[model samples]
Structures are given as structure tokens and as C-alpha cells.
Target: MTLPFPSLEDLVNVISSTVDYIVNIVYNTIRGALIDFYNWLMASIEWLLNYIRANLPFVISVVLTWTALYKSVTAENIPLTRRIMNILTAPLFSMFALSLVDALLPREIKLPRYSYPALAIASVYAETEARAEYIIRHRTGYVVEAEAETEARAIYSLGS
Candidate 1:
């Protein structure tokens, strides 16, 4: 019988050379990709920083909220009871708004988990409008503004 054999040292050298070539190619590719990605990220960050710094109003808006718009009392004719009801319901409306936000916001994005304040100044007018609607629908003397004004003058004999 005839048998063929390969030298162990020659086999090892061939495998070693092939592995070294593969490792070099992979290392260079990964290193180049990493450097490019890092440079792109740094440039993007610098651009964004400069943009925000140049736009003072944009920067301020990022820090400010819409709460200032709803803090004033705009209704002069609504009954005190309705006004008080609006005030009391502001927190409930804010809760609904936060719930809506949670429901609508995409889950994959970080929502920056925050506790809703007991009430937001931003929802105050919305609460007032809802209360006004309820009052006008279920209660007398709280009808549409024009009708209420006519009725009020009829009773008080002011503009009759």
C-alpha cells in the first residue's frame, strides 16, 4: 500500500500566513470605518452646537414652555361657579394631556420620562373652555355669549 503525507510544519506555515492576511484586511477595514464615523459624528455635533448658539431665540424657546399663555383670566361674564370649576378641573385636564402624550409618543424614542406636575399652566384655558361648554349646555343663564348678554340686559334693564 502507498500512503501520502504532508509535512506538519509546512501546513502550519500556510495556515498562519492566510490567517495573518485575513486579520490585516479586517483590521484595516474596521479601523478606517471607525475613524470616518468618528469624524462625521464630531462634525455633526459641532454644526448643531454652532446653529443653536447662533439662534438665540431658538435656544430660549428650547428652554421656555407655553405655560405663560394660559395663566390669565379672560372671561369677564362667566359666573364665579363656572370659573371655579374651570380652576379645579385644570389638573384633571393636564392629566389627560399627559396621558395623551404617553399614548401618542413613539415608544422607541426616549421620552425622557418625567412626572407630570399636578397641573400645568398651559392647560388652564382648555379646562376653562371645557367647563364653559358644560355650563352653557346644562345650566341656564350660561348660553352663547350673545344670548347670555341679551338675557342679562333683559333682567337687569341695562341696555333695554
Candidate 2:
């Protein structure tokens, strides 16, 4: 039996296409993963906000205020130069903080009779258990969701 050999131009075209396929895969993988992660984060935040609004307004306010304070502190810990720059941009930071409090705190929680600080404290107890997930979880964070999404896409393409 005679074996058929691949022609020179045919071999080159095959190699080029193969490389293109690999590149496309890698790019699509990363892009898909990021999209997935972003979608996941947005969905989670929306769920949290809606949930807090409907079933846990008071608790949501407290948790949100805590989240604001925590984020501000973290932002404050930047290197001296960046810290100075951020301080210079103080209004920007304050705006961001206020926005968090505004967005996360349900209006019902703002009734005239309510005590903001007290509610936050009460929320602290309620949200304390999940604190570590955001405060203490490993560095992967939302990035991992993106990565996993990409990996799944690549695997599916290969398997199919």
C-alpha cells in the first residue's frame, strides 16, 4: 500500500489555519471568561440589592455602610504618593462612599424614626458570617469566574 504525502502548499495552509485556530481559541477563551465573570458579578449584586430591598432592608443598609467603610479603608492604605493623590481627590472618594450608601440603603430604612447607626450594628451581626467571603476570601475573586467560564468554553469547543 502506498502512503499519500501532504503537498508543500497544502501542509503550509494547514499549519497556518491550525495556528489561527489556536489563537482564536485563546482569545475567545479569555474574552468569554471575562464576560461570564462580569455577568455573574452584576447578577449577584442585583440579587443582593433586590433581596435586601424586599426581605432585608435594614440588614442591607448596615451591610452596605460597612462595605463602604471597609472599601474606603482599603483605598486609604495605598502607597504614600497614591494616598496623597487620592486625598487630593477627596471629593471623588466621598462621592463614591456616598453613592454606595445611597445605592445600597433602602429608602424604607431611612424613615424618620430609624437610627442609621443602630441598624448598621444590627446588620453587622446578621452579615458577620459572610464577612470573610468578601473581606477574607483568597485573591481569585471575580477573576476566577471569568477564568472558569473561558476554560469551559475552550473545553466544550475541543470536546465537540
Candidate 3:
């Protein structure tokens, strides 16, 4: 029997090619799994969005009413008269607050509306006009800052 002798360069090339093939397979498998996971997450999000869209009014009503009820219930620490007022007017106030949110704020982003009741409460409880305006602007995502110079135009205008 004649013994087969492989050259060093041939052995090295064979080993290198095998390693490269295994690495490529591993990489492709991992990449494919990641892509599939991403697609599944995106589909789930789209499904949720479609569900919300299908029940827009109901969702809005529930959100507003829930926020108002939560706020009223949490006002136990406040003055009794004010707490009573908030409880009585939470429904109407919630509607107005949510309307402002829908009309003024950007639709792409759903801002936290739980703060609406607190802002409404503060606007009623505030002692100064400046404080009330500040609350209003803050709640509406419109904040005014002190300017350094007259020529210094507002860095960001509204809706920018």
C-alpha cells in the first residue's frame, strides 16, 4: 500500500476553507433568526396599532375617563373643598383636557394624559397667572424661555 502524503499548503487550505464554511453558516443562521424576530415584532406592533385605530373613540373615552378618575381618587391629600370640586368636575374637565391634547399636541406621539388632571387641578389652585400659564404651556408642550438678546430669534418655533 502506498502511503498518501498531503503537502503543508494543501492541508492549511483545506482547514481554512472548512472553518470559513462553518463560520458563514453560523453567521447566516443567526442573521436569519434576528431578521425573523424583527419582522415578528413589527407585525405585532402593526396589529396593536390597527386594533387601536379600529376602536379609536372607545380608546380615547376610556383613557380620558380613567385618567380623570385616577386623578380625583389621588387627591385625598388636597383640601377637601378642592378634592370635592375635582371629583365633581373630573368628567367635564377630562373631556376638555383630552380635546386640547388632540387638537394641540402632535398625533404621532401619544403623550401622557394622566398629568392633565393634575394640571387642571393646579391651574385652579395656582395663586399666580404666571404659574398657571407655565402649567398650561408645559402641559401643551410649549415652553417659553428667557432670551439673551433681542436679535436672537427663538431657536425652535412652534411645531418645529
Candidate 4:
């Protein structure tokens, strides 16, 4: 008499085939996802490069303007007339500075255009931080002085 159920070998074969199928499915899914991600990353980089290339001149202009304005506003040693003159002729000064730098740098070694905007942004951040610190210091000093004055008044009142 033979058993009606499948043989052990047949059951093992079926299980192995199912596992292989599932593994292949998973592998294909992951590979497709990775390819999509890679494509998106490359597209984003290309767009960024194109945008920077297109806007480089505008970026340089903004950097030069910001630098000139910041320097003119912050120059304590200069007379008011000189500061006004500097502000009025900021464009010429900026051009001269750029020309000087271009003349000084080695022709073989070119600097990236992005560095100009980055440096300008850094300078603005630094100035903002300094101004914030100054305000905070003065505010705390005023608070301390007020507290001391209040304490002195309380002491005088008690003595009287």
C-alpha cells in the first residue's frame, strides 16, 4: 500500500522553489529602487550645476555690493565725507579690487566662482553675530545696573 500524500523529496523541492522565487522578487525590487534613486540624485546635481552657472554673474555682483556696503558702514576711522564718497564710488572700488585680484592670482590656477558668494555670506553672518553679542551685553549690563540701584534704594529706605 502506498501513501496518498506527496513524497518528502517533492515537498522539499516545492519549498525550495518558493523561497528562490521570493528572493528573486525582493532582489529585483531593491535593484529598481536603487536605480531610481541614483537617477534622481544625478538629475538634482545637474540642475544645481546649471543654475549656478547661469546665476554666477548675479552672485558676484551681490557679493561685491555687500562687501562695499559693509566696509563703508563699519569703517570707524574714516571721516563722514570719506564714507559717503566710498559709498558713492563703491562700484568702481569693487571693480578695481576684482581687477587687482585677477592680476595677482596665477593664470594657471583659477578660483571657483562660488567662493565669492560664500565668503560674503560668511562675513554677513559674522557681523550679525557680533551685533547680537553687543546688544546682549548691553542689555545684561542695564539689567544689572537697575538691580543694583533698586538694592541701594531698599537699603536707604531701611536706614531711614
Q: Write the per-residue lDDT of candidate 2 for residues 1-160, one digit (tens) a residue.
A: 6449978888999999999999999997786677557656665666666666665534454565555555555784567676555545655555565566656756542211111111111124365542211111112332111123335333332322
Which digits, one per residue and each the tens of the lDDT, describe model 4 over residues 50-97? 666555545665689788888988989999999888888887766765
Clashes counted in candidate 3 amount to 0
* Pick by lDDT: 2 or 4, better one: 4
Q: Which residues of candidate 4, in runs, are more than 4 Å off?
A: 69-160
Which model, 1 or 3, shows the larger TM-score?
Answer: 3
Scored against the true structure, residue 63 in model 1 reaches a CA lDDT of 30
Q: Roughly what TM-score does model 3 have, to 2 decimal places? A: 0.38
- The predictions' CA RMSDs to the true structure, in order, are 30.7, 23.2, 22.1, 25.8
Candidate 2 residues lying further than 4 Å off, grouped into runs, are 1-4, 55-160
TM-scores, each model vs. reference: 0.34, 0.31, 0.38, 0.43
In terms of lDDT, the best-performing candidate is 4
* Superposition TM-score, candidate 4 onto the true structure: 0.43
Winner on TM-score between 1 and 2 is: 1
Instruction: Give me the overall lDDT of model 4.
Output: 0.55
Better of 2 and 3 by lDDT: 3
lDDT of 1 by residue, 83-112 (tens): 677766665565565555545544432111
The candidate that wins on TM-score is 4
What lDDT score is found at residue 17 in candidate 1? 100
- Relative to the true structure, how large is the alpha-carbon lDDT of every model? 0.46, 0.49, 0.54, 0.55
